[model samples]
Target: MLVLTRRRGQAICIGDNIRIVVTRIEDGQVRLGIESSDNVTILREELLETVKQANQSALSSAPEAFNHWLNQQPKAVDDAGNTKDKA
Candidate 1:
């Protein structure tokens, strides 16, 4: 990580389009203002981590969920496209 000391109102530039500026500092918390193109995505680290964990959990349980759904579905067709008796 490239660490730099920047005071309030100081700004940092990334590449040619992104800029981060320190907006406020109080109570040991720092607030920043970020400028970027409309296509760029900006997310907090914790929010990104939460999304990753939720996605992983969903993927891990997908097979079981699919199986449960399949079992609940009506078994109306056979492998050869023949309709099976409902009884």
Candidate 2:
């Protein structure tokens, strides 16, 4: 990774479409303001992980496969003559 120092209101450029600006520095935390094109996506770690997991799951399985897996699970019965899963 490239390392550089930027004070408040200063910015670092990444090519022509992206920029990172130093917005705040306090409590040992450095805040950055990102400037990017509309097509670019920037997300927090957990959000990124969710997106990746969703994409991977979609790619690795089909609707039919999921339905088959669901069918294999044990069914439930209730005293009211309804499936236990039914409300």
Candidate 3:
């Protein structure tokens, strides 16, 4: 981890398009402003970890759920070569 000290209004640049600016410092809290392209995704570390765990849990259950859905789908082939439900 690269750590640096910056006073208010000081900024750091990452790569060619991202910038992290120190906006304010208060009692034990530091506020930062981030500027980047719209394609960039910025997330807090804890929030990112939570999202990763949720994705893993969903993926683990997906196979069983998909198989159950496939079993319930009708095995009829339509003229367009697509699976269709029997009426």
Candidate 4:
């Protein structure tokens, strides 16, 4: 990681189309303003991690959920694809 020190109102440029400006610094917090092309996707690290964890959890439980659903379904057909009578 490249680290640089910049006071408020200073800016940093990345590549040709990205710019990050130090907009505010107060109460030990530094705020940045980023300018980028419309096609670029910017996301916070914590939110991205949360989404990944949720997706992993859902995937882990999918097979159990599917089995529960399959058990609840009506046995309307046999292995040969013939309809089975409930009676």
Each prediction's TM-score versus the true structure: 0.67, 0.63, 0.79, 0.61
Q: Given candidate 3, what's the lDDT at residue 64?
A: 97
Report the C-alpha lDDT of model 1 over 1-87, residue by residue, as the tens digit. 999999999999999999999999999999999999999989999999999999999999999998888777786888899976554
CA lDDT of every candidate: 0.93, 0.87, 0.94, 0.90
Candidate 2 residue runs with Cα over 4 Å from true position: 65-87
Ranking by TM-score: 3, 1, 2, 4
Model 2: lDDT equals 0.87
Q: Residue 22 of candidate 2: its Cα lDDT?
A: 94
Off by over 4 Å in 4: 57-87
> Candidate 1 overall Cα lDDT vs. reference?
0.93
Reference-based TM-score, model 4: 0.61
- If ranked by lDDT, best first, what sequence of candidates would result? 3, 1, 4, 2
> Which lDDT value does model 4 have at 13?
97
Candidate 2 lDDT, 1-87, residue by residue in tens: 888988998999999999989999999999999999999998989999999999989878888797888877776887786675422
Candidate 2 structure, TM-score to reference? 0.63
How far off is residue 29 in model 3, in Å?
Answer: 0.5
The most accurate candidate by TM-score is 3
